[model samples]
Target: MAEVAIRGVHKSYNKVPTVHGVDLSIADGEFVVLLGPSGCGKSTLLRMIAGLEEITAGEIAIDGTVVNALEPRERGCAMVFQNYALYPHMTVAENIGYALKVAGTRKPERRARVAAVAQSLGIAELLDRKPGTLSGGQRQRVAIGRAMIREPKVFLFDEPLSNLDAKLRAQMRIEIRRLHQRLGVTSVFVTHDQVEAMTLADRLVVLNHGRIEQIGTPTEVYRRPASRFVAGFIGAPAMNFLTGTLAADGRIAIGSGAGTPVTIGVRPDEIQLLDAPLKGTLDFEIELVEELGTGQVFYGRSGEMEMTVMRNGGGEAALPRSGQRLFLKIPMTCVHLFEVESGRRIDLPPSRLAAE
Candidate 1:
């Protein structure tokens, strides 16, 4: 295991910057995930760590040794690619043991190590099989085994499960986490999937337009987003946004037509349906209802502003359907306010928002 440090790292292609100056310190044996949308420089940053891409500026260190000048193999990093980059002609044993063979290790030792790794990954029976004969998950296990046999100080995954189906992806996620627990190797994973990032990361590094947006544990980032972009990007169905103004009375009026302008955000699950129009409640007209197995999602609008609300595990009789008008009580404790110009979050006391 190794502590990976990236300090003031920058990458560019032909004078057009792909990754801005990024500084992150990954603790030894920590599982850090770089998460963002496509073209957000997450992959570029991961490649830089693996020595696959050159750093335009700044230095990277592994286990306290500066590795900016080192070759990919010299950095003590083993990378598992998304495509399962295995030789089709080679059997699983040969594929996993290839690195040892290249380093001039004896065949008997190589076979022993390959068997051990295959056994650990539960692919020992498939050691004689070729890549073409294996399923996607099996091929991925072979790829992981290939990386594992090297016993590198660091493991890098570049969206390795993106090619699998949903069920296989979930299974691989658990397997990867188990491997991390059993081996305790320092790992860095890059992905555009929030679910993958949330489930796999000890800490998530959120990136956007070549810059780091936020770095925190999944719950911290979800419960208290630093910016509007993060609040919108991290949740399912996304957070609902409204243009409003904070009045002197500490109450928020739900439209631009009033008070000191600010942006309000609330998650779909945070809204409470009301029996009557309370002083702090907003009027909503339900246009559609979606019945998910665990809950129901209501899509509607409050005046001209579109909104979405989620109700978890309620009976059909207790739920409202399309064409129903309802009142929504947005608790001040659950509300997030942001600056209209900067999009940064504003922290407010609940007592200040009490209904008059």
Candidate 2:
């Protein structure tokens, strides 16, 4: 296991920068995920660390040794690509032990390492099969096993699960996490899937347009986002944003053209159908109801403001219907206020906004 450090790194093509100056330190045995939308430079940054891309400026060091000038193989890192880059004609055993063979390890030792890695990845029985004879998930395992046989200090995953089916992807995700825990090798996984980053990473590095947006543990970024971009990007059904202003008395007023004053952001889960605070309730026209097993998501127009509400399995006897008016109660504590112009969060003191 080795720690990887990137200092003021920059990369470009024909003088047009793709990766801005990025400084990141990935601890030994830590699974740090680079997460962002496509064209956001996450993959470019990963390639740079793998020594696949030349840095326009700055330094990269692995295990305390500067390796900006080193080749990918010399850097002692193994990369698993988005496409399962397995040899079509080579059997699983041959593919996994090819690197060892090239490095001139004897047949016995090479076979032992291949079998060990295959067993760890649960693909030992498939050793004699060729890539074409295996399923996508099996092929991916072979790809990973090939990398494991190299015994590199750092493991780089470039959206390795992107090509698998949804069910297979979920299964592979758990397997990958378990494998990492068992091997305890330092890993950098790049993916655009927010759920993948949230569930797999020890820490997530959120990127936007070739620059770092925020870096934190999954819980920290999800709970206390640094900016509106992050707040909206990290959550599912994404956090709804309504333009509003801070009143002189610290109240938030939102709406457009004869709009009502809505001082708070009510997370879907926080809003409830209740009788109390009758005056505070917003009248909503239910447009859709999606039943998601344990809960249901209500989507509708609350006056001119769009809103979503999450309700547990059992609630008030009456279920909302299309075009029906319903009162939605929003607790003050669940509200998040932000400065309208700058889009930064407002640190509202507790004394002013009393909670239920």
Candidate 2's C-alpha runs over 4 A off are 256-266, 275-277, 315-317, 349-356
lDDT tens digits by residue: candidate 1, 171-202: 99999999999999999999999999999999
* Candidate 2 local distance difference test against the native: 0.84
Model 1: lowest-lDDT 10 consecutive positions: 347-356
User: Would you estimate the TM-scores of all the predictions?
Assistant: 0.96, 0.91
Q: In candidate 1, how many Å is residue 285 off?
A: 1.7
lDDT of each: 0.92, 0.84
Residue-pair clashes per prediction, in order, are 0, 0
> What is the overall TM-score of model 2 with all chains considered together?
0.91
RMSD of each: 1.6, 2.9
